[model samples]
Target: MADSTPLLSDSESDKPPEPKRPPRSLDETIERCIGGFGWLQIFQAILVSLAWVFDAQQTFISVFTDAEPSWHCADESVCSSFSNICQLPKGSWSWDWPAHTSIISEWGHQCSTSFITGLPASSFFMGCLVGGLVLATLADSTLGRKNMLLFSCLTMSLSSIFTVFSPNIWIYSALRFMNGFGRATVGTCALVLSTELVGKRWRGQVGVIGFFCFTLGFLSLPVMAYVNRSSSWRTLYLWISVPTILYCILVHFLIPESPRWLFVKGRKEEAVTTLKGLAQTASALTMSFSNVLIEQESLDDNVDIYSSIRILLNKRWAAHRLTAVMVTGFGIGMVYYGMPLGLGNLSVNLYLGVTLNALSELPASLITFFLIGKINRKDSILGFTILSGVCSVLCVVMGRVWPSLQIAMELISFFSACTAFNMTLIYTLELFPTCVRNSALSMVRQALVFGGVFSPLLVAAGRKNNLISFGVFGMAIGICGLPLIGLPETKGGVICDTMDEEEHRQTEKGSAAIPTLA
Candidate 1:
């Protein structure tokens, strides 16, 4: 036994030293050094969230800008200010709005030109599709989150600026498409960057701020539209664009590259500098934070930016999860984007309708911010989707029998849909690791845009048929949720850094497990 013990000691001496783990995770280190929910973190998140505001405004601006104007019969010049122009014969009516106010009004779009009016909205969504396919990878790779966000914001703002000068609807539609292309990465990049900047304990709180900003932007639209009701729509574009252009400059100066992403790319020195800045901001007494550089959490992030999606899709479970989330997101996207465009069928005040619809986002944001921390993400997504779907179906059934009741129900559905959208985004953030998080989200959001591409066409073609507008949205969201049954609950699990780790994680959680944020 003594001889054997010496042999064991010799063998042990020859073994390599076990690699040391990081003293604490980046999230933990940030919290301990900078204080949990620190002002520095909050300020960074708020700055990043400004992008959401501009994104939301530009996304829904078309509802006001492209809307068909009120009109009266040209022959019936005797018609006073008191009558409904829609009641008169369609062919005799000319637009009440000036050519510069709305493209539909400027181009003399009656029945003959009605189809072209939907083109701009569709074109914008199509641009989103193309951009997501193209630009999503840059954030995960060389450009990083801050750079991609700044670029997207700059491009989107510049596109909006140029849109104000378009000579015709065709040029205007083309510019809007370019704007969509530029804006495609803004929400994804902003959300990922801002959330990663904070500790896990504060991630939910910080994430909700983006949604709140989006809701604020939505609310602002009605007020802006009302204030500019008599002015050219071009003026609205110009007003919104200038601030965003300035925001791009602020982001460049203020927002740092995501430290998490820097570590993923093996840029440890930069990560050290970023953390040092955070410590300095919090007035940390000790800046000897060499532990931040000692051990990076994982090296599984995509070094090959071009094949990030391939890395994601090549994994079986990942492919399945992505497929399901994207399909469901498409359904949600259709409803979220469709409601504003379809509101005119309710025969309510356009301004009031927009205000009410926009107002719904407030409660949606509050409810989402409140419950997401408590409930399971799957339960929240599945339950809210069902509720929103029911409300939409009711809108169609009760639209004629009780018009006022129908509007109320539609608003409820819109609010519910917004809540579902918020939950889905939060849930999506947990589904992938830091390596592919931005890319996955970018692609999923593009699925929403793909669904949105069809919404404007449907709203225009099915103006009289409430079922085509509301019913399709309801059915798609309600039924598409079936696939979610196969997806696991991802409420309290660690995010997997590699496909193998994630697959094993799914097994340990009993096969129905979904990815989760830690």
Candidate 2:
């Protein structure tokens, strides 16, 4: 306490205060550099989105290419697809379509082996589950967004092309697994990269593009399948494979590395170059800073990079968010992937049924975009999931009475599930820190695949009892959404760039009281 106010000399007192590290925010710098969303940025985003297109394509292609075609029995004694051959004349019991065109007819899996027919579809999801878990950290660590995308795209393309050479169902299923494994990182990396390429103002818009692309890819399946209806199922695989390979090559040549990633990696010069290229492409003003930077590097550059899962788990609040999000995603995944596959059991028009289901995506996307802006994500997801569950029960109730009405109910169910799925995509991006965003999303995707893993089996049993099939789907979606109600409204929260920032922001958010109008 001695001479508390008399310590500073004249020279020391005159020294200018050391500038408070310029509010050093890396996320702010990235948004500033990206500026307003431009046409050039849109082009890049579109090109990168090819990954999303093929991801959707490969996922649902089995609905047509692997379907069990309609068949009549040779005789009451001889069985076929849902028909007793013994009840019909010998020559009248032939397949309605050529055997070579479908996996079911071609392999004689129609009657006796029908129960296990779901193995291949289940196998694909299993592969996705394994691959997503194994490769979840790759994008966040070494491959970065562009390279991870290129790798996933190439792997999926090559695997699909090789599927054309499968000798039997065993070989075909193996190839499908490989294909699923290869494509595992595509959507996660593509989504993360696309959002990262833009500023906050355009993030929601950029996010919307992914849903549209996925819907387009889903829609393309029916068209491609319709065109190849007379052709062998192998043609469908080859159809998607060849074009996919060419597109991947184009993607390799076009898309740029995410500059934010470069900056975080201490590659500031490269980051500057990427920013410059973006500016030049858009014909916009270049950044004019000779001294301080936007604080791109992390505060602890000396610390070794940790896996996203580890980082997420280390923080209590982050761990809580991760658990809730992944669980909800799992439930949504079951309905989203399982409903369409289960629709094969519908007695209505198969082609028309799929077409209607694909069309449901458009409304889902539009609705999700509109609702996400108005209310919070938590409510939207919760509402849509419960609706999907209700519709699932409705599908069973109407299934036996009116097949058309049943199919109509099923369509609504798919539509609701699809909306919930879309919400999960954007909602996930908002939950985690940017440093490990890709990995976190990938982990959640694996959780989704885990749920998808069991759906094929459910669909297989669906024909026997609609209750068991749709009931599980209903319960899964409805129950999982309960935990999400506790999460705060993240409608206007900024995407946190680092663990420290996310923790601090969440702390502030927890302590702050909601304002009430008098």
lDDT against the true structure, each candidate: 0.80, 0.78
Which stretches of candidate 2 lie above 4 Å from their native place?
A: 1-22, 73-82, 85-92, 112-115, 280-284, 289-294, 299-306, 400-403, 511-518
Per-residue CA lDDT of model 1 for 14-102, tens digit only, reads 99999854234455556655665667778999999989999999899988898877775677554554365545565555667665678
Root-mean-square deviation (CA) per prediction: 3.8, 4.5
- Relative to the true structure, candidate 1 reaches a TM of 0.91
**TM-score for each model:** 0.91, 0.90
RMSD (Cα, Å) of model 1: 3.8
lDDT of candidate 1 vs native? 0.80
